[model samples]
Target: MHITMHDIYKSFGTNRVLTGVNFDLQEGEIHALMGENGAGKSTLMNILIGLHQRDQGTIMIDDKETYFESPKEAEQRGIAFIHQELNVWSDMTVLDNLFIGKERTSNFGLLNMKEMKALATEQFRKLSVSIPLNQEAGKCSVGEKQMIEIAKALMTDAKVIVMDEPTAALTEREIRKLFEVIASLKKDGVSIVYISHRMEEIFEICDRITVMRDGKTVDTKAIPETNFDDVVKKMVGREITDRYPERTSNLGEIVLEVKNTSKKGQFKDVSFSLRAGEILGFSGLMGSGRTEIMRTVFGIDSLDKGEIWVHGKKVSIRNPEDAVKAGIGFVTEDRKDEGLVLDFSIRDNMVLTNLHSFAPKGLIKDKKEQEFVDVLIKRLQIKTQSSATLVRSLSGGNQQKVVIAKWIGIGLSVLILDEPTRGVDVGAKREIYQLMNELTERGVAIIMVSSELPEVLGMSDRILVVHEGHISGELSKQEATQENIMTLATGGQ
Candidate 1:
């Protein structure tokens, strides 16, 4: 075995997150760790990478017992981790990001510029990525940034690598390139602990799969021996018979219309009409103006020139507050940055949108607020001990639920969801999709922006492919395919 974690136990304060977790990975194998949201997948990965120490456990690496005191120590011991949150300096160059902490120094403690640059260039070439060593990292696309994060792991000469949702922001082509890199690394005898929400990816690349549920190991099986349903059942402790609920609402008149919408350098000439009970999907690469258009529509970004019609009436939305007042709700792409207040309690985050409505003379009505939050928590099935728990303590999947629930409380007519299921697990994603269907059934119009092609195609009634700050093509549900979307999104229209 390349790595073995036995009887792992971890907790935060009085809450036990991971309990008696056991996992093993063989050399040259991609071991998959599957679990529901807040099932302790990330906690286990953090423990392995030395971000969080296990309360009790035995880790055997390379036939010897090992304990990592810090992330640096883990890297020194040939273990590297790429967290879901891309950790890279935006101001630094790609080369600098890869060799930031592991730079080669002389015996006198002097920096070795020539050797470092040479090594960085060699690694970039080997990875088949053409990145300027001196260019700022912020100028790169999300895929490029993700590639830089992956390359950074290689700098440590990592014998074992743990990637948590690495492909969340990557395009299909970029994901393919990453798979190729993983294959090369496997041939070089590196064991990979791959954690992803995509079932296709797990079956495609991983050799063995370990499923966890409620902080316990449910099963460990070979990839070919099990299917998606089996894995999902193991993770959620329930069978998901239906992934997306049926859409059974009659189409209504256009509720939101954006005509000739342009934000100058950001997005241009984006025109679309959304009707009641319609879920319009915006598909594109990371920098292809999908999120920019959503931000512009939500009034988070200034629109240089455009006209927005709400129910056939012209509306001027200068800010997010104005957008909210106009019966529009926006769920941003970066959940950690814009979605929820990590330090705030679930009840606080839930009622934040309508806090003023629940307040009298600037004093919050605790009874009224609690009533609504309690209903929402149960309705959404948010996995939390209490509504008073911090939003940060909840898993990524549950945090996304809180985001959706927040917008749902607004009684929105036009909902714009950007990467709604970006970090959400399968079961939670299904719940979200069902929730979208329920909203539309009640005549709510939705505009969804997603990088995952299957989701865009599966959930949207119509998909608009954006490329270079403009819409390249638009397709109905029957006409949309991954190939067609990618071709148009890459300017091959």
Candidate 2:
């Protein structure tokens, strides 16, 4: 199958998202869509998949003009999409989520659990995934959920698959497995539309690349013809000399400390100390209890046994509110599920954490709130028409920024960041790193949980490697390297 979109234009109210964009996909090849968040890559795809109508565009498939009325129509035409955000049904079992709308049924029209489980098991095996078919989808880790999404898409018998940030949550081992699966699919004459901000992976897997900027298509080139610098220049329209901003923060006394923390079936005997003006980097594979440990610290999940101390005083945090009162803020890994209310406006989401500070005596000072929101929006470079804009409409990168802004307004003593730059582009990523540097300069301690080795090595003053719920090893910034971190993360000596 071959697909082409030309002269695409889209707008929401007064916000112009995409204008005069051109993209094309060829059979038996991998085409990459590279851009910063809100650059209209997603909008163009959404228009193609019939989720949204294009105000102006021409879509052609196999030399004939074609437009899908719904995603079901596109799926029936052999096109599948694995979105950046995982779409797993939390309450449903893994098998159910795998065949959600199109379940297998017997001759009598009764449900066929055995057939569904067998198909799901085969897909998981192909992806080298080990998740149980009977487990609740929500119980799976982010990486596991990511793999499930990929497997579900593969089960569609799609000739063309559009994958957006598919490996953002995957571990090195799983990433390798996914790459192998992609290779096999390509060999089977499937065309792939790969979207990711990871430059390395794009160059490694894609055959051609298309970059968008400010609602326009900058250029398209073969992967062999374009270098990483060229693609980034087109994506952000600027030369990024440093991938990561230099870190300079003097360490102070420990601000938050956890001792002998244990969460049943998650982590065990975990202990760590976070000091003011220092970035404590948590390095580990996904599902290695890194996120669970932070959830326990933030009181989202209970610690079966542990002691938490803030500012050298013990605090009993029974819930997230209690954790907030104790001066700890958490930027959760799953932003859509835990960080922001999709239905709420950007302003409303920003003030969720600092409501007490803004609303004295149950009265909100609208002027002060607006000013605060405006300042952070400018500081963070969040692309939004107005604070009244709903958060659900913002791009993934901007949504993550809102989550960070909400926690930043709380004036917490300790901040826990999980996968802070998972879907962020190069320019915005530098901006975030600069913000972290400034925050540390202001004496706020941060515990960053990241799967990106370069981020851990670049921004952290100290690093702790986690393997299967244990603190396998700790290393200073000067001593840590990718090899050492991987060795420790994989439970090697």
Candidate 3:
């Protein structure tokens, strides 16, 4: 089922989202849609799947002009959308979640649970997924849920599947499994619209690439015809000469020290020291307890046993507020779910962490708040029309910037970032790396937890490998290598 969209235009109130966009997908081909966040990639897909109406455009499927009034209508036409945020009922069993809304019923209106479970098992077998049918959906891992989502699409006999950031939260092994499943689906003649910010994956799995920028179609090319540099230049409209900024070694006195930190089942005996103007990276595979250690240090989780000292003064942090007051800032990994208040405006999110500073008299000063937001917007290069725009309206990369900006507003001695560039494009990643360089230059210490090996190696002055709730090994920048990191992360010597 070939799909073609021509001269598509869409707008939200006064915001013109997509302007004269053109896209095409060939049958049985895994075509990639590449762009920076807010480049109208989602909007275009939404319009195609009948989630939004296009102001002007033509949609053709199999040589027939078609118009879908709703997502159900699109689904009936063999279109399925697997959202980045998996849509599943955590309280329901895996079988129930798979057959959700479309459950088979008897003549008396009773659910056919037996049929549903059998069908779900069949689909899982087809996808080579081993999730238990009776288990609660929430109990399954992120990778398992992703496989379930794909199996659900197959149950609908979907010919065209739209996957949004499918591998954002997946580990390297899980990603390889997903790629294998995708290969099988392609062989079965299913077309996939793959959207992701990772350039390496695009070259690996996609047959063709479509680049979008600022609500317009920039270029489309075969994967073999173009290189990563060429695709990045088209996406950001500028040549990113450096993937990571050069850092100067300017180590200062120890800023933070954690001795014998332990969290019963989460992590144990974690000891580390961080110095001013240094980037300390924590590397590990999924479920290696890297995030747990950071959470405990940030006061989000209680440490069973440990001693923490800030600038040689022992401090007790019982909560996030206490940590914040002690001059520590944390940018959480799940930015949308944990970092930002989506309903709030850019100004509100920017000043969320430092509200007390703007409201010393117990009432917010609107003028002072706007001035502060204006400066931050300029400083962080957050692309937005006005400070009044809701945070939900911004793109993923810009939203991440707002999260970082919120922490930056509150003066910090140490900063913690977890998967900081998870869903952002290459261009935004360079900007973030430069921001880190700037922060370290001011003598601020940074602790970063990243699953991406290259990012950890490129940005960290020191790397610590975690494995199953313990620090297995530590390496200097000169000594760290991918093989060594992986070996240590997998409980090697």
Best by TM-score: 2
lDDT of 1 by residue, 78-123 (tens): 8889987678788887777878877789888998888888988887
**Model 3 stretches astray by more than 4 angstroms:** 88-96, 104-109, 112-155
Worst-scoring 10-residue span by lDDT in model 2: 406-415
Give one digit per residue, the lDDT tens place, for model 2 in 367-466. Answer: 9999999999999999998999999999999999999999876678899999999898888999999999999998999999998898899999999999
Can you tell me which runs of candidate 2 are displaced by over 4 Å?
A: none
Ranking by TM-score: 2, 1, 3
lDDT of each: 0.87, 0.92, 0.88
After TM-score superposition, what is the CA distance of residue 463 in candidate 1 from its true location, in Å?
A: 1.0
In model 3, what lDDT does residue 462 have? 98
Model 1, which residues run further than 4 Å from truth?
90-96, 104-144
Residue 32's lDDT within candidate 3 is 97
The better-scoring model by TM-score among 1 and 2 is 2
Total clashing residue pairs per candidate?
0, 0, 0
How close to the true structure is residue 52 of candidate 1, measured as C-alpha lDDT?
Answer: 91
